[model samples]
Target: MSTNSRWWFADLVLVVGLASFSGSIALTGLDGPLRVAFVLPLVLFLPGYAFISAIFPEAGNDDTRKFGSDKSEAIYAVGGPERVGLSVTVSVAIVPLVAAIANFTPWGIRVLPIVIGVLGFTVLSALGAFVRRWRVPANQRYSIGLPKLLFNSVGRHSNGSTTMVNIGIVISLLLVTSSVGFAVLSQPTGQQFTEFYVEGQNINSNTNTFYQSNLGDNGITVNVGNREGEQTQYTVIAVLERVENGSVTEQNRFDQQQVTVQSRQTKQVTLNGNPSLSGDNVRVRLLLYKGDPSGSPYRVIRLWLSS
Candidate 1:
């Protein structure tokens, strides 16, 4: 599937990255794993590949690689000037630094923005490297040797001594690929309340009258763990209702709390004994919603504090 034996590896990586990025958007539920696969290379290898390319774009010619064998050998990666090593150091540090900076912004360490930033950086660096490489004379460009090592390490080898190194590279790449696959398959999917329960901590009961007027609440404390698949706004409404002649109506509204929660975020809201709803028959009803109370609830818990 590749034509350039020496630089086909880079082509394959870009192609696969494009495919994964597309799949993550189009495939609906299976987007998680495909995205993981794409992001690993974007963050880890792609930028470095571009940096290496810029440093040694013109050096892939075979004559330079086999210039003089036996003791006066081909330099593996350290063949270039001191600037090469300095460039390498800076290139390696750039992406992680970008990621740390990205976290401080409003995007807040999300996959989409991060993947976009890293990939964009990689591409721009690569284009600069390309322009620089083409400007140098062909014979002069032959001095850069890192490109020989990066994209076509195995095929470039004319001897058996470096077989072990090539094998190690293949094995390491496979292990990383497998790890991405595992991450995609293991990610949780869908939305619903992970946990919802009410605890009446400060509840004081005296002869059928359940009442509390503490600084926080004399009513139940509602805990919600929102594992609901998306970053969404939610409202928690707790109403103390009265039932007369087998008909129910709202009497005292305790908690009308509204919060915007992220996926897998946990929150706690209290339904206080604000006025201590009483008078023979009363029930406390709590509902957790995704957007508003008009929609169907993700969870509902009803308790008869006094019936």
Candidate 2:
């Protein structure tokens, strides 16, 4: 057969071989073997095309006459419709292959090869077609270097489209993945806590000072005093309860009993819990450990009752 016919046949064989292998892998769900199977065909095809062209220099001569005829014109030789069409076909085919590979790997590693392969094919094909159309004279467009010329031309245009498409797809994928991850993290587990209260008293008179109601039942609020003009830290050790007339009520509700106080500074403490305070008189004591009680450093602890 003529060199041109041989070259075309080789191209057809390579394309068919790759397509068949890809389809088989997709159908059979064989990931590891597929990765290796793709390499040999690619290696063989390029050399085979070159060898065929060398043997039939007449075909190459024709390509040169047809495309190399123009050196000065700003030909849209790279991004022509035919090249664009081929690239689109390759890209579209890759999506399904990627999906199939992704089925095998939740991590999505398998999909990467498909994407790379598709992109490489599109780029190489476009470039080859472009070089063929541009470097050869108009009459000698079928030269041995035609493939290179065609690819070079098409490569320039497809690159811009490829970049835009790839970036958009990647960003969309990341957003979807992140949203799913966040949803999985927001589920609740069952748990409950015990009720308690804290009361404030005047150290001088040993008398009830500022009496506050149930601090645990609903929520507790306490005012920490800083007398020494320094920073202080307090740790709440226990919750105390008080009983009155006929019902029980939280006397002093301390959301935060133990708190660090800056010298001469005082802040209100708030705690969440169910305190039963529904009587005439009630007093609750909160045991506290003071640490650097005169410092401005403080950390909030969330208390939960174990039920």
Candidate 3:
């Protein structure tokens, strides 16, 4: 085959591979299958374009050359065997890297930042590809090659080292400003509390633990209103630890912590309901107080209720 033909064939395979890889990442990262439906067409089209390009090689050389020659074009030059090896290497390496990072990270809510970072990187990579293409000169512009299209759709945007340094400085300034705001906000603010109500009338304490069990029992069941205006019985599986001076001393089991109710009703059974109730109609009031815990320096809360 001629160099032109060889180049075209290589371009075609590279585009298809990239599209496939990007589609895989998108499908994996995203929550739903809807993206796959949208991406399948593009995936199919990449190879299809290659086939058509082979048949009609002379039709659109300028556009093709422009779009196909971006950063992705360089990666495609590594022969077929090398290309496969690169793919395998990336796939194998990513898992352990993620695992190692996660292992070193702190537990509880603090780990959220790391998770957000990973997602941000993926998004930024996709965005960067598009930004690069957009910044390219019009005269030097290329056709919509498959790899460019996929990366443009999926990667993050970043200026090279210099731009990144500037961005870091800007981000540091913003963070400093935010820290000042947080410090101002955190100082000796009056206590704030959220109130949730539980419907007492429909609640059947006989079958539920609230009537039968003592403190630190297995579970408590309560009834709350459902979407249809009918009352539905729900079981509160855990109890909230009492808050003293704005902090919860103990953690409750998962089952008794929160009661799930239908969206239609505004009232939710609080874990801190009254422990003493003899009559059929008993009102349970739960109060949740928030405060900072000792040593950890993290703010926490405890719950208390009266029936």
Candidate 4:
């Protein structure tokens, strides 16, 4: 291919791969199939590929192969294989590193933040790859070998027999397809929601303590967790009630709040209550309404706290 064509084509892999990855973030509601289509490749390999290309743009040049006799070529090449290997290794680590940092923020470990972080890295690396290639002499500019390396190796053997090679390719494709399907199925559907009692005055967090003074002073904490892939409205109502074996008596409302939680995040709402709720085996009920608190709750948590 011509130089201009090669440059444009080479750039497309990183550009489109990341675009596809980020686009999948919006598909969080679609679940399984979309996941297999986009998420895994971006998470597992694309970042590494981009970074490696940046540092070792020539790894895919005519001189090297990732396996067999050519495996050591990257080491012996002008850049040296060790540096190339390190680039590849660090590229892989980028995903987890971004995820760990994002988790501490409001984003958590959700699809959007992770994808954006990776795509940012991917774009930077792609730019580096372009610069690195641009400096190379005209004669040395070679096509990337990844496609040939992965797709071509499927069935060919030293002897190059067509029958065996064809069969091997078929088997390999089948395994890959099966693995992808399994991954999609095995991945947790980042859906559903959770409602739990939290420490007094902090609805967004769990204190794990029951007797918090805020629990009875017209103050209550209810945390609602949503992984529904979009902004969801929820109503949290804390009801103070007493149940007498096979009978119920005297229910009073202590606190109520309407709040919204982003997809793949948790939000806490501290409602108001009086200290009278303390002691006497009072049942503190936390009801989470998906859209309307007055309507049936999607989840309910009953906690018995002593003031």
lDDT of each: 0.56, 0.40, 0.36, 0.59
RMSD of each: 10.5, 20.7, 17.6, 7.6
Estimate candidate 2's alpha-carbon lDDT, on a 0 to 1 scale: 0.40
Per TM-score, what order, best first? 4, 1, 3, 2
- The 10-residue segment with the lowest total lDDT in model 1: 76-85
Give per-residue lDDT, candidate 2, residue 17.
53
Residue 38 miss distance in model 4 (angstroms)? 2.8
Q: lDDT tens digits, residues 1-307, model 2?
A: 1223324334434554565454444333232333335532332232223222222223233322233445422333222233323333344355466556666665565534654544355335534544444444444333323333233332234466755654564455446434544443333333211122334331212333233333434454555665432355666533444555655454444333455555444566665554544343444444444663344324222222211
State, as a TM-score between 0 and 1, how close model 1 is to the true structure.
0.48
lDDT by residue for model 3 (178-285), tens? 554455345453332232333343334444323334432423333343333222333333344444465554443433343344324434444433343333333222
The positional error of residue 305 in candidate 3, measured at the CA in angstroms, is 16
Candidate topping lDDT: 4
Q: Candidate 3 versus the native: TM-score? A: 0.26
TM-score of each: 0.48, 0.22, 0.26, 0.54
Give the winner by TM-score: 3 or 4. 4
lDDT of 1 by residue, 1-307 (tens): 1223344235434634653464354323333455555455554455655666565554433344544545344443232222233343454476677778789999977656665666666767667665765575544442323444433432244345555554555566667557756855566555344567665544333342343334234446677776655566878888777877878865777778887765556677766546456655676678887677887777887665533
Error of 1 at 4 (Å): 10
